[model samples]
Target: MSRIQFDSVTKRYEADILAVDNFNLDIHDGEFLTLVGPSGSGKSTLLRMLAGLEEITEGEIRIGDTPVNRLPPRKRDIAMVFQNYALYPHLSVRDNMAFGLKRSTDLPAEEINERVREAAELMGIEELLDQKPKHLSGGQRQRVATGRAIVRDPAVFLFDEPLSNLDAKLRKHMRTELQRLQQTFETTTIYVTHDQEEAMTMSDRIAILDTGTLQQVGSPREVYNRPKNTFVAQFIGSPSMNMFVSKLDRSGDRPRFVGDIDLPISERQAESIAARSDADQFLLGVRPEHIHVHETSVEESVRAFVDIIEPLGSNDLLYFELESNIDVTSVIGNSIDIGEDEQGDEEEYKVFIEPESIPQRYENSDDPVYLTFDTEYVHVFDPETGENLSLDQRSTPEAQTESATGAGD
Candidate 1:
């Protein structure tokens, strides 16, 4: 298996459109990395560039130490499994698995057959070896395609949304199966998908993309719990994180985020924000799970009208909007300064609150409700840059020591 490198890689189309914009990343040897983002986010384009299906407009890509920007797909020693399975309708599973090895190498018939058999066994499709693609189920066909890649023993494995065509239950099963297979083979794998769940569950590290630019690349824990920017924070979570422009105010010893939404800052949080230049005016982010909604008032709780209640069996999602409905369209679309839009009276800021902390009286009620959340869980971002301010707070030795001491006490 090889460690891949993308050094300032870029792709452009005829109309001066940038499909991928100077992407630079390193995929470690035998690591399972997933490229994930929304539609038209350049994830598939990036994958295709690596697989040699498309040309890089500029820069270089390397497998291990060898630059492969000019290499053909066959010479790259990369095996790809596509979303459609791409199995031959006429060829049996055994032949499909052996085709690449036969054509690419001088392996004898006996060795080729043995390799195919081993691949089928590993994929749990040993019994279906002789069946043609027409006779095989979607999941079975996917297995055969994977088996074909496996027998080749390529330097890297590329998967392009291979589970997109499967049913939900089957997709879940295949996700686990694929993880197990990667673990067994210890092959460097790069998977591209629009599904965040697949990326979160399968990848050792996930690379998040948006509009052709890389947003963040980190482990699931780091990406989900400690996002670097507004996009990462919103995109990585379920129902997404609530983002709103808030005004920061200081009154004597205390500080608070006020205007449409309200959140009080503690001494530690205030100290953290005090270290920043644009801390007084920035975007405020809080996940649904971090919000505590209530019918009864609590300290640091602010009132809002309940917009909706979505029940998710074990838990509930309570959505609320500010009474004033401050418009943050530009702030949400791009990381811009949140100025008071005199005509934005129609826009209401929305926040998702988990109902576990709410009283049953406010279950499905549309009445005014109160919300209380920890200041530690609140993430503050620059109004114009969208960069997380709390990350700076966490990076310092003083902050780390203080946080560690607080946790211990």
Candidate 2:
């Protein structure tokens, strides 16, 4: 009954501006969903509309069973926590938390105070409730802002990059706290952020937006392991998925992909590619963890030259140039020439590898390297439309896809 539905929602700024376009979604009651993308992706605009702070340009927005398109901000029965922590500078934590209740509800003073005290305690800011906003630390101020929203006990919670102001460690700590609070309250929440890490770590489902369109919506792992397009594939990961636009040509007796680089595919992959071979070119995506990087030559490995090595304690990301993918693109049928880089240069692609798997001599070295990707791990996308061409064969680990299943703690 607490579900929020957006039916063909569109937001336009001017004749030239299309902020949101034809958006449709059903957020289940008690679910935690996140809207994530780069700047100007309409996530914040979408949140503002849900809060009734921004008017809908077209279509309907409903809270449970009620149409809220014409409702004012105060009448929406929703609470929002902003990135800036909009606390009243002159008010103490207790006053800031209780202000909304006094304005919207005629609760007894004893009850208001009790609710304020309860929210303060829940946010671990009770000791600072009597102190002004200027007297509290950044984290404490954030807690106060969230506590203010909590006391409203609204049907829906809207967060607009609320943790963006905190330091890395504190932001991580508060991520857990917010999850715990949602679990305890079981309120439906829609959060907005540009941080894919935050969205992936905290959301029950993530809705990715680009330009003004909703790219895809699914569990973290489903999107990560089986992205719908090139944008989703590239945007959702840390190191970003390695990509190369190449042509797939039927080998004399087998199947393979051709670009600046050439790949002889496995039988299973060959079958999948053959089924979708109507396209002359495809965009290939491989997660960093699935690619094996090495210094010495290995069978079925493509020789490459390392470009960069980023170490992260647990794993190292290896960037290398794929000459075949870059060099042969000019020769692919009807493909636009990508202007040759010098004579031997190619585009760079990255691979995530464990340090133990790297040869010591090649460790941190950008010297010639050999790379191999498993057939089961790579995803194929249509070059023109960016749809997953190999959708049926896309695979993801169970542990990874279940990691962020429903948003509650």
Candidate 3:
């Protein structure tokens, strides 16, 4: 296994288009690092540059201590599994698995066969050794392609959306298999994918990019719970985050957020906002899970109308519209208490409530419902720069939570 490093790496196409910009990262030995971003975000381009499939316009890429900018693809000691599987139609599974070993190294036929058998066994495709790619399912073809890379036993593994072709269930299964393989081999891995969920599930660390610029690199929990900026916040979460344009009102004893809607913030959040930035206004961000919908009015709760309700099977998403036109969403438990007289054995049963009977939910102009933002789970961001004001060099989710709840005191 080997650690890989990208030092101020950049890739440019023609005289204008910049694909990857001054990217720098250190992938630890045996680390599974994923490059994730939206389409045309340069994740695939960065992977290609490292694999020697594309040339770097600036900076250097090092595999272990060796700089590979001048090395050929065959000499990079890396194996890549592409999105399309890239399997040869004419070759059988065993031959396809052994193809790289045969051409790249002058190993004896017996040794190559042994390696192929081992890789096939490891990938659980030993039974399909003689089958051609045409006869295999998409998942099976994916395994064959991965087994081809495994037989090489390279120091590093590069996967470019290797499971993109498989169905959702198969993709999830393959994700588990890939993680297992990484643990078993402990080879350094760099995966490139546009799928944020896949990246979050598979990577030891995720490197997120946007428009060819590196955004954030952290563990899944770190990026999800304590994003450094608004872009990372909205991009990583499902249903995204609700951002409100607000001005800080410090005239009162306790500062509050006002503009799109009126809201209360913890004293600590207010202090952090004041100390970290000089702007008159900032954006308040709240994730769907952090917003609470109440059947009755509560302190600091704003009255809203239930614009829409989305029943996700596991959870129900409640969309609320404030009088000020701010759109807010809350994720609530789908399981509701069925009355004792109901047919169900259990007191609680999961079911989608009809739009008409959302527990006497608010109509556009009828009964008013209330929504409250969980201040401890909220984020304050610079409206201009989009940087999280609560973040410092040593701050983390726990720290932010402590500050918000006055536990730090």
Candidate 4:
């Protein structure tokens, strides 16, 4: 497998529209990287550029040490698996797998047969070798397509939402299988998918794209725990992180979070928040698991009304409406027996906000909710720029340490 690099890549379809922005990334050799984003985010366009299927409007794309901007698709030594299993309907699985090799090289019939058999065995589709694509199930047909790529042993494998055609259960199963195949082959893989769950589970590192620009590129935990901006924070989580607008004001000698509820900020946190010159108002971001029903009074707390409770088998998700009209959710243990609504009556339940749960401030709002966060976990961002002030500080040493630790762990 080879390393791929996109140096300031840009794709403009027309005078007014730009499909991909100035994208720059270094995909390591033999690494499994996923390009994840919503549709029209230019993930597919980027993949096509790498595959030599589309022209690069600007910048350079290199495969291994060679610049492939002028090279045809055949010279790129890459195999692509599309969303639709693009197999000849009349050809059997074995024939489909061998077709590429038959056209590319003048291998003897015996050699082609051996290679096809090996690929089929690797993909666990040996039993379906003689079956035509029309007769095989969706999963089986997908395996056949994968087998086609495997036989060629391309330097890079490009997957364009290959699992989108499968049912949910089948898709999950194939995700594991695909990871295993990549590991066994050690081929540099670039997978494009809109499914966040797929990106989170399969990729060694995820590259999040939005509006043709790279939003964030990191391991799943890094992006989820320490988002680079408001967009990344909101996009990465399931229930989504809760954000509230508040004002930063000084009460006597110390800085305090003044809003629907007033709470004192620690000296360290206050200094850090004050360091950002662009921050006039502050936005608070908290995850569902971090907020809980406060049993005792702490330094920071918010009085909120419980709106709805969703009981998951392992945990319960509590949704609350704050005084600012912003909705926040907390995940509580299912073992705790909070009485359910007998007559479907919604009551005002007091939820607690831990001091550590408060996120960094961005801008002030008229109606605000009182919030607090663990100073260490708080993420600060610039409202106008939509850039994370804490990302560079938190991403460098912490990110490297995390990578090493995760490898061992």
Candidate 5:
């Protein structure tokens, strides 16, 4: 079993700079876990430590029952694919893929050749085996690099931004291919990337790191729907979450957020906020998609004037000015049509209505637009600590289980 464990691992450089602080994680066998964060967040540092390229300043790392803290890179039973592909220009793809096994093991030449051929076939690069790295495209070279690691058949696969060098379309394709390979091979894989979208789409679970500290760990839906903190809420989403600093007014029958504009909360939400904290001030958060726009005034709707509109494919992002210095954005999409499938399943097919076909457009309007917040989708945060106070109140048991932040617990 290739279950990996990191126990209070810490990395410190000169001048007492900590790269990874008390990092702890348990990667189950055959699980795909992605470590994601911004630059200088120590994600790569953790991967290097696991690969035995860096020394641990404190704590231990284990593979199954064996502690591997002192193991050399060659003895760690892990294969790493670097961002640059790291192919030998003079070597043919077959030789490049067979190089590690030839140097590290006593396998016969015939067996090595068979292993290389199998790996090449698995990567769908068998046709390019006779060609050198200099003649291959970027994506082909990436496949060769991955095929090289596959030939090793290690207990763990470590990918350090392996798809970063590919074009956007190619990167998407490669990630999908990699996911299929991991599922087929069932190796405990640890992937590191700065792209949160990649992490969300590809990982079984994601670990968010920042400045040598672990911020959160959860499934994609758990992290997206119920973020643990403000930083995570802003980092994992595409346009990020909109936040407003406001004071809580309890004098009214229902609690209301008072700032440049007033936003009333349901009694249940008020009770949850009161139970979570005693702070009178909070950072109110709502995703752009949750804010709705209407042509006329509705109950609990706020009046706003259009500031800007950005068309993004099927959806248009509308920015509005509610009051001076208070700007909000809402994503509006044309209505979706459900087409009947051959089997008469309406859920099988969905067609998006064309934006130009819509008669009433909110683009660059001078007239006031009424906005309403979906209270069920809203989040309340501690302004000083940045913690999400509403996470536990609304999160389901499955999400809570998938979102537990403790390491090896």
Candidate 6:
């Protein structure tokens, strides 16, 4: 395994279109780094560049200490697993896995058999060694493809949506298998997938790409909890964070988040907001799990009309619409006893947002939902620039603090 580096990498297909723009990253040795983004996000192009399947239009890509810009795929010492199984239908699984080694070297027949047997065992496909690709199941075929890569013992492993074709159940099972395999092999791996869950669950660190630009690169928790901008915030979450426009106002010593509903801020947060000249228009972001429904009175709470309720067994998802027409979703635990008998009927529900839950408030409208967040859980972003304003570009401290506070709360 080796450390991979991309320095100011840019890939342009045409003069006007840029597939990857100024991409720079350092992937640690033996790390499983996942490149996650929607379609047309340049993840595939970036992987192809690393595999030597595509030319680098500009900048450099280094594997270990060697520059591999001019090296061919085979010479780069990298193994790539494509989305399709890409197995030879005529060859048996054992022969398929041995194809690369046989072509590259005239190793003894005994050594080739030993290597292929080891790879099949590692991938738990030893039972299907004699079967051809056409006779194998989808999962078995996938393992055959992986076994082919494993036998190479390359410096780096590259995967491009390797699980996209599997059924949901099988995909989940393979996810666990892949994670375990990575740990066992300890090979430097770069995986590209549009599935956010795959990226979150499988990667040691995730790099989010959008519109040919690297938006955020950090651990899964760091990117999810403290996204660098509104786009990252919305893209990373499943139910997506709730956002609204509100203005910041100073009421005495503390800055108050004034909207359709009014909420007070902490002294430190107030001071922070007060010092910022650009704090006038900030977006308020809160996760679905952070919004709570309280039967009892709270110091800071907003009155919202419950629009719909979706019972999801272990948890109930409550959807509410504020007077401003902004919809907010809250996930209440299954143990919570709420009046579900009045389902499908509009009713007034008391929504309590902790002060920390409220991120920087925007000043676009007065009729804003008074959104409060656990100060530790809040994420502040610039509405105009779409950049995070809470902490530095790296979100270590903020993410740790938020997670600890969230667990305790």
Q: Please report how far candidate 3 places residue 235 from its true position, in Å.
A: 0.8
Q: For residue 245, what is the lDDT in candidate 3?
A: 64
Weakest 10 consecutive residues of candidate 6 by summed lDDT:
332-341
Evaluated at residue 364, the lDDT of candidate 3 is 48
Question: Model 2: which residue pairs collide?
Answer: 260-324, 260-325, 261-324, 261-325
Report how far residue 379 has shifted in candidate 4, in Å.
2.3
- Candidate 3 runs further than 4 Å off: 266-268, 326-365, 393-409
lDDT of 2 by residue, 221-285 (tens): 78888776677887888767776766787766767876744577766776776676567777677
TM-score of 4: 0.83
Error of 6 at 46 (Å): 0.5
Ranking 2 against 3 by lDDT, winner:
2
TM-score for each candidate, following the candidate numbering:
0.88, 0.89, 0.87, 0.83, 0.88, 0.83
By summed lDDT, which 10 consecutive residues of candidate 1 come out lowest? Answer: 400-409
Q: What TM-score would candidate 1 get against the native?
A: 0.88
Model 2 regions more than 4 Å off? 266-277, 327-347, 356-367, 395-409
Q: What is the clash tally of candidate 2?
A: 4
**CA shift of 351, model 4, Å:** 10
Candidate 4 lDDT over 1-409, as tens digits, reads 3999888899999775888988888889999999988778899999999999999999999999999999999889999899997999888888899988988888999999999999999889999998889998898989999889889999999999999999999999999999999999899999999888899899998888877877778888888887766667766766566555555786569777665335566676666667764466555555666555543445677755445455554555555666653222122122211112234222222233343232322112233334345545555555555555555555678675544312200
Per-model lDDT: 0.78, 0.80, 0.78, 0.73, 0.79, 0.73
- Write candidate 6's Cα lDDT for 259-358 as tens digits: 6345566677656654553646565666677766553446677655545455555565555666653221222222221112224221233233343232
lDDT of candidate 4 at residue 2, scale 0 to 100: 92
TM-score for predicted model 2 compared with the true structure: 0.89
